[model samples]
Every structure is written in structure tokens, then in C-alpha cells.
Target: MVTSPEEMQNEANKKFCVVVGNTVTGICTTSNAPADAKCTATDPGKVTVTSVPSDHLTILGTLSTTNIIMANWSKAMWQSVVNRAIRMLAWGPLGSHFFSAFATVN
Candidate 1:
């Protein structure tokens, strides 16, 4: 995990791998990733994937939302938002399932 600004910069400099059919097709960086490739990173880690080749919609959705949340909210604030959401869903029939599926950052 990246623990400092310098580490984050270094991680950003690293090339992202682009694979197809169990074989690597190319390598790219944040600035040059293909239009179809979605790349996202937080202080802790990064994720990159080709949108068309991958069928993991849940992963894509989580990555997108997590990136947005981390970009806009501090840890404490984010936790508060999550807690509020949990509370709001507490009375629902799907409360347990929602809580289990909800993502939280450490």
C-alpha cells in the first residue's frame, strides 16, 4: 500500500498491464491508458481493467464509487456517510444483505 505522497507518485509512474484472453496485450500508464480501459487508484492501491473484455460489473462499479468517495471525503467523513447509510437501511427487509455487501475502507 502507498503510505506517502512519494509512494503514490511512484505507483502512478508504474505501467498498467492490459491483458486479453489470458495473455498480456500491452502495457500503459495513467496518461496513456486506452480509451476503453478504466484505471483508478487511491492512496493504498490501484486497479486497471479493459471495460470490454471483463465481465466483472460489480468490481467496476465498486472501483468507480470507491475512487470517487476517497477523492471527495476524509476517512472520518466517509465512515460517517457509511454509518448513516447503514442506519437508513436498518429497517429494510434486505438490511442484512446490504450491510454484508457494503464496502468499508480500513
Candidate 2:
């Protein structure tokens, strides 16, 4: 569980939640995770599951759909580093330099 997805994105630049589907899908941010289960982050029903901190991620069924969305423990801070990187690239030198030099360094 990530404390703040927004901060993570700005600082780290990666998707906060894996949003796995089919019980557990597309949550392979860490190769250690079951990459074989590359399911999309689609709605996997409305079942409430307990979100486990990365510290407790080793526990079985720790990475559930509902739990991930509604948990208190946060192991790693999530963000949109990948997407932001693409955006920075798309913006070219102009966007990168503009934001880095003038943007608020929160």
C-alpha cells in the first residue's frame, strides 16, 4: 500500500496501484511478483479484501483488488513515474526544463 500516489508519481514516477484483475492482475511492478499473472486492472467484482503492506505482501491473498484500494498499511509509495517520463519526453526539452526550473518544488 502506498501512502500517497500523487507524491509517489512526482517523486518516483510509477503507477501507485497495480489494479490487478481476475483476483490478481497486472500488478507486477516488482518482478518478484507473479509476472505470469499479467491481468489488467479491471473491476474484479466488489469484494473487500485486506491490503497487506509490502512488508506483509508475502502473506497469501495479500494482493487483492478491493483491499489494495482500501488499506491503511503502505509499504511502497506509488506514483506515475513511467507515464510522467513519457510526458516529459513528449514535451521535449521545453517541457522538462520549464517544469524542473520554474515548477513548484513541493
- The most accurate candidate by lDDT is 1
lDDT tens per residue, model 1, 15-42: 5667666645555455433333345543
TM-score of 2: 0.15
Q: How far is candidate 1 from the true structure (C-alpha RMSD, Å)?
A: 16.5
TM-score versus the correct structure, for each prediction: 0.27, 0.15
Which candidate gets the maximum TM-score versus the true structure?
1
lDDT of each candidate versus the true structure? 0.52, 0.36
- Ten consecutive residues with minimal summed lDDT in candidate 2? 97-106
Per-residue lDDT tens digits of candidate 2, residues 1-106? 6668665443432223444442332222322222232323233431123343555333222233357554443433222333454467458665633323211111
Candidate 2 — which residues are off by over 4 angstroms? Answer: 1-79, 94-106
Candidate 1 Cα outliers beyond 4 Å, as residue runs: 1-70, 92-103
